[model samples]
Structures are given as structure tokens and as C-alpha cells.
Target chain A: MAPQPKHLSGDKAAINEFLDQFDVFLLDCDGVLWSGDNLFPGTVETLELLRSKGKQVVFVTNNSTKSRADYQKKLTSMGIPSSVDEIFASAYSSAIYISRILKVPPPRNKVYVLGESGIETELKSEGIEFIGGTDPSYRRDITPEDYKGIADGSLLDDNVGIVLAGLDFHVNYLKLSHAYHYLARGAKFLATNTDSTLPSNHTFFPGAGSISIPLINMTGQQPTALGKPSQAMMDSIEGKFQFDRKRTCMVGDRLDTDIRFGIEGKLGGTLAVLTGVSKKEEWDAEGAPVIPAFYVEKLSDLMG
Target chain B: MAPQPKHLSGDKAAINEFLDQFDVFLLDCDGVLWSGDNLFPGTVETLELLRSKGKQVVFVTNNSTKSRADYQKKLTSMGIPSSVDEIFASAYSSAIYISRILKVPPPRNKVYVLGESGIETELKSEGIEFIGGTDPSYRRDITPEDYKGIADGSLLDDNVGIVLAGLDFHVNYLKLSHAYHYLARGAKFLATNTDSTLPSNHTFFPGAGSISIPLINMTGQQPTALGKPSQAMMDSIEGKFQFDRKRTCMVGDRLDTDIRFGIEGKLGGTLAVLTGVSKKEEWDAEGAPVIPAFYVEKLSDLMG
Candidate 1:
């Protein structure tokens, strides 16, 4: 049998002991810090307390909808201090993986991107030229005849060696056609994340995973997912931050993505807070794939 | 341990004996008689030959893009005799299945459709009312704000009890959002077919399955697929033309959809042609899931 997830109480000694084990804290954004721009009680104080203790903090979000700069601005706007360097979103991670890891050289590294401006921003920041994302030409509604014309190479762009897909609001048939073309022609396929749903002000919208599933099904090839729960994102983070795995703790609200991220990344430990999606029943369930290292009702409980 | 697919040559005696085994012939369209608008050589003659031998011929296609009337016109335009009655497309089959089998009576039977005009036409022909599909309102480009508004009930349709998705050239976030709303509200989910890619003119385009996958992933609920290889399609066919299974032969170009349809339907036999997607290597591979009963280089070979 494996070790069970330890429950952490509000006792000051216990909380201090828990904090003493880690020198760095990695946090999931949507559920832990805030829920769709609504900050949970004591979130700011908890972060400040960690900072006061001289612990390193990083925001790891699977939100491909926003670039690292965008996330930094949002955090600043929310009265939380953040820097672009401290944010590790899937979009940036994917761009880094494609540029640094894949070694896709310039001029021939034109990617057919199926995502929003966030992905475009990251790729552009990395000096990666791409097409088809957020372009009005590819955003138009397509007909069956348009698809035929696309299939015949009438609108195909040459030298597209990579196809990267993320959460895109302007997803259209033309974009799908281009992605399918590059994928069929042996272009490298990458996705920011496979988060099925994006939680907003109490409900959920289709996430990047939902957007990529169609292309995956069409090409019969799984993409190199660069997000939480995938070891690739860990490699990207490790390459950039050089954090000590023995002193890093991941704090998240979801078991599948966040806790799994910590587990797969070989982090020191994972802390699950109940201010988000998972419940006590789910955490106590048998044969859970992602039980955390510790559980707390809220991250603010540590302030006690 | 099982029987192998017999190779058919142009032996007149053997051809006649083979033809004698089936009184009905079901054909897949895209790769069988035609590839896009250009018909295969001797396709008309082959159909005529089947008809002359007193066989009932039905065109079964997973192409949800066109209505039965549209297919009839296309067939007549191509000089192949066909009627709307002889066509059992997934669009029509799905419409019939929803209206009749599901028995979603009027007033509450309004469907939130995520497809093209073909699905709308079929649903209307079946006396079923629908919204969202080809609605023009849902065809516009949406932003994250639009998705948020849709998630918050600003754009939700009232009493949409069924969400039927098929191949829609105008697929967008708005349509998917509405479908998600209905599904989350306990509406029945239905898909015409889950054919991954639509092959046309030697290239593949995204199919209805590609369109429906996102919604399927978002809801975590599998839609009832009404198309080839599914027994529901067989039930729909039986409800219309009461043909003898022992005397029916399914002819198709693909193994997964066409041959599997015959095998799952328990038809007399299946004939696979080499003019389409499946190759000889795949057919001869060990543990192939859908091995046909016979193989021919071309259906035109039998017309000889």
C-alpha cells in the first residue's frame, strides 16, 4: 500500500512544520488564488505570509487563454503581486518547448497555430513565426466547397512544419483544415493543455483539450501536451527555474491535474485545498490516482 | 481460426454465383461509386447491373452534409438512377431516430442542433423543430465574453431537450456553448455519426465525429451515434425497408465503418473494394477488427 494523504489542521505548530518542509511553493491559479477573478478569503494574506517566510512562489496555470504577460497584468489588477518571470502558463511552456526543445529553426518553423492571441504572443515573443491563429482570413465561416478547395491545396501555406493548438474562441473550419493538412503532412503536433472544461464565474466552457480533441481524432495522433499532469511542462519549468525538487511543494485545488502534476514531477509534496473543485469524499475515495501529500480546508488555514 | 475475405475476379460464372447470394445491396458513397463529384469508371453500369439482376440497392452514407433530396439530385445529375427513398444517410437516420425511437413529443421535442442545413432539412422533414443549427445567429465569430454570456444563460434556448450534432461547416463556439447548456441541463445528446475524417478528392476533411468530439468531451456523456457500424442505423433501416438480412450484401471502401457495419448488422456478407481508404496490408493484418467477406480491386470488376 502507498502512503495516505496527510491531513493538516489549523494548529500553528502543524502549519509551521508543514511550511518548514518546503522552500518553494508552486500554485495553480484558477482555484487556489481566485475563482474567475474573485479572490477567496485570506488568499492575499497566505501568499504574503509565504513571502515573509522567504519562500519562493510561482504561479503554474493551464490557462492557455492568457499569455504570461496577460496573467501578470491580471494578477496586478487583482491586487496580487506577480511578475511575468514567475508565471508559467501552458502557452508559454509550449512555446518554449517548441523553440528550445524541438529546435525548430527559423524561416522553416512557420507553425499553423489553432489558438488565441495568447499563443501567438508567446510564439512571437520567442521569435517563432506562425500563421492561421486569430487571422481574419482563417476565421471566416467555411462551406463544403471551401473545404474542398482547402483539401486541394488552394489555400495551404507552404513550409508549415508545426501545428500547435490551444484554447481558441475563434476556432473555425479553415483553421481545422490547416491543422489537419500540416498534421497529415507529418508536421509536429503540440497542444497547450487538454483541460476539458474552463471554469468561469460558476460554470464551465470548453477548454483547450476540447479544442484539440477534434484534431487528435482527425489525425489519429496524440499531441505533445505541454501542461499540468504532463511531464513535459515539468521539464520546461525545470529548465527555466532550476528549482530544488526536494524543497518544492505544489499547492492546488484539483486532484487530477495539480496533484498529478506534483506527483509526476517528483516534487517534495502536494497540498490540496478545499476552496475549489475537489471534495472530501473524492479525496477519501479508494484507488484515487492523485491523492495529495496533505489536505487543508483552505490555504489560509496555514495562517493560524 | 476465422474465415478469410475471398478475392473476387472477373469470372463470369463465379460473378453470377456471387451475385445470386444477395437480393439487396447497400453501398457507401464517397469511395464506392464516386470520389467527390467525379464518379468511378463503370459505377453507373455497376448499379444498373445490380438493378437488372432484380436487387434492391440502397445508398448508405455517413455524409451528413447533404440531405436525401440533395443526394437524389446529385445521383440523378450523375446519370445514376436514385430516389430519396433509396438513401439512408446519417442525417436522415438520426432525424428519424430522434423523432420516432426517442419519442420526444412536440413542444418539448425542440432540438438544439449543431450541424449544417442538411440536418435541419431532415429534422424538418421528420416534423421535428430545432434551433441553433444554421440559425445565422449562432454562426457569428465569438469571443471569450460571448462565451461567458452564453454560459450565463443570456443566449440559452428554452426547452431544448435534445442536442443533435453532425457535420457543420459553420461550427463555432456559440453553437458548442448552446449544446453544452442543453446537455448539462439533462437534454439527450445525439450525433449523426462519429466518422473521424471525411475523404474527398483524395484528401480528408474533418467529419461530424470531429465536430461532436468537443461536446462529448465537455459533457463527459457519449452521444447515441446513429450511423454506420452502429446497430441503431440498422434498426432505422429495418424500420423503413424490411429487407432480408440473409440476402443483403454491404459494399464499402473502408473497413471500420463499412465492413464493420455489415458484420455488426449481421448482413449476408460484405464486399471491400480497394478504391478507398483501407489497404490490403491493413486487411491482412492480424487481429483486424473488421474483415470483410470478399475483396475486389474495383466494383467495376464485377460489372465486367
Candidate 2:
């Protein structure tokens, strides 16, 4: 466990003092900006205040189910105008990492994707061939039986180089079994995010983290998590923005994912909010990993 | 770790001599009888030999996906002929235990099943009302939106006494979230088994054990696992058959499930067999639990 940082309480004066120190703001989506469809009170005012002070804000979400285009649309409809480039999604981060690290030479190798169209589109855009056993056209038509051929090694004969696990609606036993087989055969296993659960309408639902964790436990193999709270996400930010690590802050709700990510990535500091998936009582009850540098009632509280 | 038995070895002749002392057989399915489709060679001969010597045998499988009838059919197809009454499935065991322990008035109490038809059928047969949520019937038509109504305590208005988790085909985030809610609200959390993996067509698939373990970890709650390898299963056998625990031998292929069950239940001895889920190399590897009383190449090796 890392040392806890001094926390500025949710009081107006303390929050304003903490916000004045950061130049760049990296915010988490579901738990920080909004929970599903409902935005935290005063989110718009907070963003306006942050921008007024010349702080570059990026909406980073681990949910690979939605593309950047989808997030941009959602944010716009929610009274927050965000550009596509400003929205950094796990799918985009994973694609960039795969393209750079495991670059198969031109006439790129086929990838067996167990993910949504966001991942499919990203892989295609990167000059990678997608060899899908399930119906590529119909999103929910992929069943466990479809991937049985892959598990038995028949699908890999066509130069399949990587097994990418993002968010697939049709994830089943066979797909997981096949992914394990391909991974055992030295194929790279790239997961979009390690968020165990995703926010739904009322409660959290199992995400890519739940599925990927089991495979990792069974095969004794760990896939590179390319989503927020991973260091890879921070690396992407640092590489692209040329921002000073000690000057950037990760502001989010969930302690396990957001705050831990900030601490592990060696980011400047973390600001935890109480308006999302996690509550103050729950957060305090279970001793949080690293104490946030600041705590606020909502994002707007950051500017007093 | 328990003390290693004196006659334990991966030898054929020594195993045969040791098997002559037992008159009652308690067999675990996944690792003992067969793994996936391939039947362990000499299993049928071993069973026939036991029956010839007036030994009573009972097949106990912790997999709650199927009923005793399903196991009967599966075992019969694989050359192991046994009636439904002769086999004990976890679904049946769970239902029996729940009915006996809870002692809810007939047709009054409701059970939320996070399992398959086997559990539902058994609960219904016991005159317990089945509160439907995420099963095969509802999962096909319902989206994440439909789950909000059930999870937030709207649908559970009546007397929901227990939350039974067995083998669910649609064990999604929504169902698990709802189950957690019910459990937190003083409802009983009863699981079918704790075996992490089950034998599939050609390999091991994630079982109820994997699903239940995570929930247990998350909730900091230990559920009553009414399945084989549990002390409850062994007690059920002793109560029903009036069998002497000191003279009975539990035969299985896996050390964690089968051999451990026998030792923990204080049964006489255990027979470990090869040609199933557990390999000799795995057993020989470091840090495994107590060795079986006898280890054979196959079940039939005990007859000679």
C-alpha cells in the first residue's frame, strides 16, 4: 500500500485550494461525471470553471461497450459538449497499444475479436484483419458453439496473431475456452478494461474485468488491461499530451479504480467525489487504498 | 493437511488389494467416472465388479446444471447404467436441505433461483414458490433496463426467504447484482457447489464454483454449499442409506473435490484414479493436499 496524501475536505474553501494546484484534469466517466443517465448536480458549472482556469479536461471512461463517438454524443446530450478527441475510451487506448507494441507486419495478421464494433472498427482502422467465427453483421448472434472451432485449433490455422477481448454481448463458455487456447498457443491476450462491474440503469453489471479475470486465473496468464485505471492509460496520456505527471490529477468517484489508478500511475494527486457509484460511508467504512488528495461533494465543488 | 494414508501409491496391484475392503462406494463424477466425453477406461468393469460383490454404489456429482434424471441419462449413454434414484445431484441435495432446514410452510415462501431448471424444478416440487428474474426464459427478451425493476426491490414484494444459486445459463451482472441485494437484505444465500471448473466437451469450463466464490469474496459471506464434496452431501448419504462411514470408500479423480471430500467427511478411505480430470503429474506436484489411500491407473484397475 502507498502512503496516504493529505485530503482537502468537501468544504468549499478546501476544494478550491486543491483545484488551483492542477493544470490538467483527467476525469473518469460513470462514477465521476455521471452515473448512467443522471449527471451529478453542478457538473456543467464545474467543467466551465475548470476550462476558465485553462485546465485541459479529458473524459476517460473504461467502458469499451461504447465508442468515443457514442460517448461524445452522450456527453453532448447531457449538457456537456465534448469533442471526439477529448473523450479517451478504453477501446481506443487498447487499439493504440496493440498497434504499437505487437505490430504484425503489413498485410496485418487476422485478430479474433470477442468485443463490440468499437474494437472491431479500431482494429480495422489499424490495418488488422478481423477473422470472426460469429456473425460480424449481427451483434448478438455469436454463441458459445461458434467459438468451439477456435478452441479446437481449427480457426488458428489462418495466421491469427492476437486474441482481443473487449466487450462482446455473446461471451460464453466456448469463446472463453477458445481465448484460453489461443492465449496458451502464444497469441497475445489484450483486454480493453479491468473494471469488474459496469454501471447499468440501477445497479452494476459484470464487465470485461469479470470475464478476463477468470481466464487469467485459469491459465495463469494476465492480459494487458488497456483501460482507465491502468498505467497504460496514463502512459498514453503522457505520450500524447507531453504533460508533467506531477501536475496532472485524476478526479473520479470509485476508490478502487480511479484513486488506485492515479496512485499507481504516479499521477500528481487524486480527487474523490461522492456523487457516483461509491458513497462516503462505504468508502470510509472499508479503508480506501490511498487517501485522495481532495474530497468533494460533486465536480462543481472543486471551484468553491 | 491431513496425514498421508499408508497404502497410497500410483500402483495397480496395491490398489486392487486395498479396494477389497470396501462394500459401499461414494463416487464423484467429473473427475472420477469421466471427463468430458472420454470415459476413463475400465470404469464400467469396475462398477460391474463392485455390484457383483454385493457392493452398493452411488454416483454423486456436484454439478447442479442437471438433475438426477439428466445424470442417469448421461451416465447410461456412457456405459454406466444407473437409475435416477441411484444418483445424487447437487440440485436435489440443495432442495432437500433447504426444505428440511428452512421448514417454510408449503407454497408460502418464495425462492429466487440464480440457477438452472434443475433447481427451479426441485423448489417447485417442494411446493416452494419460484420468484422469476434472470432465467433462460427472461434473459432472451429482457435488456439491462428490465433488470432495474427487479433489483431495486420492486419485484420482490412477497415472502422471499432464500436466494438459491445453482447452475444458471444466464448468470449475468443483472442477476448477480439482484442476488447480492437480496442477500444483503437478510435473505439466505445458498450455493450449489464450490468446484471452480467442470468438465466440458473437450476441456474444463467455468462452473458454479467460480461464480459463487467471487460473490462470497465480495460479500464477505459464506454460503451453505449443498453439493457433493460438502459435509452436507456426506451427511445426507449417511442419513439416507444408514451406511457405516468407517467402511465406506469415496472414489474420485480430483484431489480437491473427491479425495478432500472423503477425508473431510471422515469417510474410511479414498481412491484416486487417473484417466480423468486430474493427471498424475498434477497430483505429484508440490503443495497438493493429502494423498488418497489408493491410486490406480483407472477405476477397473482396482478389480484385478
Candidate 3:
């Protein structure tokens, strides 16, 4: 069995010692800072404390539907101090990875976007050309003539070398069919994240990972995911922030994605807040996949 | 090492013995009788020969995009002389299984379809009430207000208790989102078939199974697939046709679906036709998943 996490709220000394250990702090948003549109109490004060203590705070979110700028606006609206650079949305991670890392060759260097405007916006900022997402022509119901054209290779763009998938509100069989043809013809497959479901309006809907499942089935391939729990996202963060791995702490509300992401990324430690999805009973259960280094009833406990 | 399949085309005596052993012949359409829109030279002659020998011919197909009536019309146009009763489409299998076997009861019995009109046609024929499939109101892009409505449980129908998925050409994010909501609200899930890619226009496209994948990911549940290679499909065929399992010979080009379907269903034997997907090289390979009882270079070779 995994070692039990230390209860931080019970000891003020433990909280101070924990705060002093990390120069940089990585935080997950949705379940930690707030639930849906409502912000958690002391969210601003907690971040202010971290900043006053000379700690670097970066908001790392797996939601690919929002670009970094978009996230910054949401954070601002929620009264959280944030900058575009400090926000590492999965959409931005995918864009930077595609541009600075994957680097598909020129002439056939475009990506076929099977996602939302967030991906397109990030890709455009990275100067990575893309097609297909939110395009009116590709959004319509596919006709028999389109089928014939697809079979003959006339309906598809030859320049699409990478198929980047994220959560898409307008996802249709037309987009899926086009993605299938591109993948079948040997294009690389990538996803911003593979989170199964998205939390919205105090409930959950299908996530970006759900979007890739059908393509994965059709192509017999799982796309390289650039989200929480994937080392690629961690590498990008490390590369950009230049943080000391041994002194940087990761904090979140979910055990599977956020805590696991911190542990698998080999950060100094992971802190779990109980105000969200996981509870103490989950880690205490038999054969837990991940256990946090410390736990608190909520994020505001660090204010002590 | 596995034993090699018996080659039926090389010897006339072997073909006769093979044909005499079975009272019924189960055929897969696309690869066996024809490839795309072109019918093989001896397809009609082979069917006529089998009927003259007092054998029952049943067309078993995993394609759910077309109903039995639609299949009969295509067969009639191609001079295949197939009757509606002789066809056991996956769509028809799902309708019968849902209406007769599963029998979801009371006011919450209507199905929400995430497939094409073929499934709608079959379910309608079976007198099962359904919604969502090909519904013009349900085919558009989802909005923020719609998300709120879905989360608050006003947009979704309370009568929907089952979500059936198959190949849908017009499948969109709206349909997937609605299905996810229904499924999350305790609705049973069913699928016509889970074939990964649909073979069409002499090429390949995303199959019915692809449509079910996203929902499976979101729900973390695999639906009961009422199609080829599943026992439920075999049971339905057996219940309707009333044929002895040991006297039925299954014939198709694909080893994974057709041959495995027959073998797993405990049919007398399975014949491999090399015109569609699988070849002798596949079954002859070490640690092969499936091997046919006999091999033919093409379906028409049995006419000898």
C-alpha cells in the first residue's frame, strides 16, 4: 500500500514548511480554484500569499477548448491574477509542441484541425498552418458526391501532414471521415489532451479524449496526448519555466490526472485539495493508482 | 504452429465434399458476392447452384447503414436474386434484440439513436419508439444555452432509456453530446455493429463501430454489440432461421469478423474467400487469431 498523505490543515507548521519547500508551484484550475463559474473562497488570497513568499505560480489546465489568452480572461473575470505566459492550456502546449518539436516538413506541413477555435488560434499564433476546423464546407452533411470525391482523393487536402484533435463542439461525421482518410494515408495523429469528460455548468460533458476515440478505433492508433499525466506536457512546462524539478510542487484536486501528472513528471511533491472530485477515502482505498504527498480540506487551508 | 487451411479451389472432389456437408450457407456480401458495385462473374451461378442442391442461403452482413429492404433492392439491381427474409442485417439484429430480448419497460422505453436512417427504419419496423436519429432539430451545432439545458435536464427527453449507435454519415458533436447525457442519466447502450472501418466505393471509411467509440470512452462502458461475431447476433439468426448450427457453413473474405463469427458461434465450418480483406498468408502466420476451415481464391470457385 502507498504511504498516507500528511494532513496539512491540522498543522500550521507543516503548511509553512510545505510552502517554503517549493520556489515554483504548478496548479490545476477547475476543481481546485473553483467549481464551474463560482470561485473558491481565499483563492485570490492564497495566490497572493504564494507570490508574496516569492513563489512562481503557473496555472496548468488540460482543457484544450481555451487558449492561454482565453484562460487569462477567465482567470481575470474570476479575480485571479494571471498572465497569458503563466497559463499553460493544453491547446498552447499542442501548438508549441507541433511548432518547436514535431516540426512536420514544409510544402506538406499543414495540420488538419478536428477541434475548436482554441486549437486553430494557438496553431495560428505558432505560425503552424491548419485546415478543416470550423470550416463551413467541412461542417455540412456529407453527400454521395462527397463520398465519391473522398474515394478518388479530390475532396481531401494533400498538405495536411498532422491531424491535431481537441474537444470540438461542431464535431461531425464529415470531419471524422476527412480525418480518417488523412490518417489512413499516413498523417501523424496528435491530441491536446485525453481527459474523458469535461466539467461544465456544475455537471460533466464529453471531453477532448472522447473526440479521439472514434479516430483511434478507425485508424488503430492512439494519438500522442499532450495533457496532464503525459510527460510531454511536463517537458514543455519544464523547458519554458526553467524551474528546479526538486523544488517545484504540483497541486490539484484530482488524483488520476493532476496528482498523477505531478508524480509521473517527477516533481518534488503533489498536494491534493478535497474540495473537488477525489476524497481521502480514495487514496486510503486498497491499491490506489496514485497518492498525494499532502492533503487539505480545501485550497484556502494553505492560508494558515 | 497452426495447421494450414485446406485449399478448396485446387480440387473438384474437395469442393463437392465441402458443399455436401452443409445444409445452409452464410455469406458476407461486399467481399464474397461482389466488390463495391461490381458483382463477381459467378456470384449468381454459385447461389443458383447452392439452391439447386437444397441449401438455405442467408446473407449476413455487419454493415448497419443499410436495412434488409435496402440490401434486397441493391441485390435485385445486381441480379443477385436475394429476398428480404434471406438477409440478416446488423441493423435488423439490433432492432429485434432491443424490442424482443432486452425489452426496456414503461414510459422510459424510447430509444435515442446516434446512427443513420437504416437503424431508424429497422427499429420502426419492430414498433420501437425512437428519437434523435436524422432529426433536423438535433443535427445542428450545440450552443452555450444548449449546454446549460443539457446539464439542467430540460433539453433531454425523460422517456429516452436506451442509446443505440451505428454508422452515421451525419454524426455530429450535438448527437454525441445528447447521447452522452442520456447514457450518463442511466440509459442502456446498444450498437448495431462495431466494425472499425466501412468498406465503400472500392475503398474504406469509418465504420459503425467508430461511432460507438466516443460514447464508450465517455461512459467507460462497452455497449452490447448486436452484430457479426457476437453471440447475440448469432442467437437472433438462429431464432429466426431455425437451422442446425452444425450444418451451417459461413463464407466471407475477412477472418476476424466472418470466420471468427462462424467459429465462435459453433457453426459446422467456415470458408475463406480471398477477394476482400484476408488472405491465406494471414491465417498461415504463427499465432494467428483465426483460421477458416477451407480457403477459396474467390467465392465463385465453389461453383465448380
Instruction: Write model 3 residue lDDT over B79-127, tens digit each, in one string.
Output: 9998899999999999999988998897999999987788899999999
- Candidate 1 ranges with C-alpha deviation above 4 Å: A143-149, A152-154, B143-149, B152-154
- Flag the better candidate by lDDT, 2 or 3: 3
Please give, as one word, the docking class of candidate 2: acceptable
**Whole-model lDDT per candidate:** 0.87, 0.71, 0.90
- Residue pairs clashing in model 3 are none
Clashes of each: 0, 0, 0
Error of 1 at B137 (Å): 0.5
For model 1, residues A1-304, the per-residue Cα lDDT tens digits are 5567777866778788989999999999887888877888888898999999999899999989789999899999888887789999999999899988998765568888888999999999988889988888787866666766777867676678899989998887777877888898888999999988888758987789888999999988999999998989999998899999989999999998999899889999999988899887776777766789998888888888
Query: Could you give candidate 2's per-residue lDDT for residues B1-304 as a string of tens digits?
Result: 4444443345656655666677789988766777777787777887888888888898988878777777788998898888776788888787777776656664435777887777776676556677653445435433655567655667554577777777665665445656666666667778888666555646555667656654564456778888767888777667667888878998888777788889898888888877666666665657656577767676666665
After superposition, which runs of candidate 3 have C-alpha atoms over 4 Å from their true positions? none
**Tens-place lDDT digits, model 2, residues A1-304:** 4344445545666666677778888898776777778887778888998888898898888878677787788899888977887878887777777776667764435677777777766666666677643443333433566446545666554466777777665555455555666666777777888666666765655567766765666667778788877888777667667887788899888787788788898888888887776666544555564567667776766656
State which candidate has the highest lDDT: 3
lDDT for B142 (candidate 3): 81
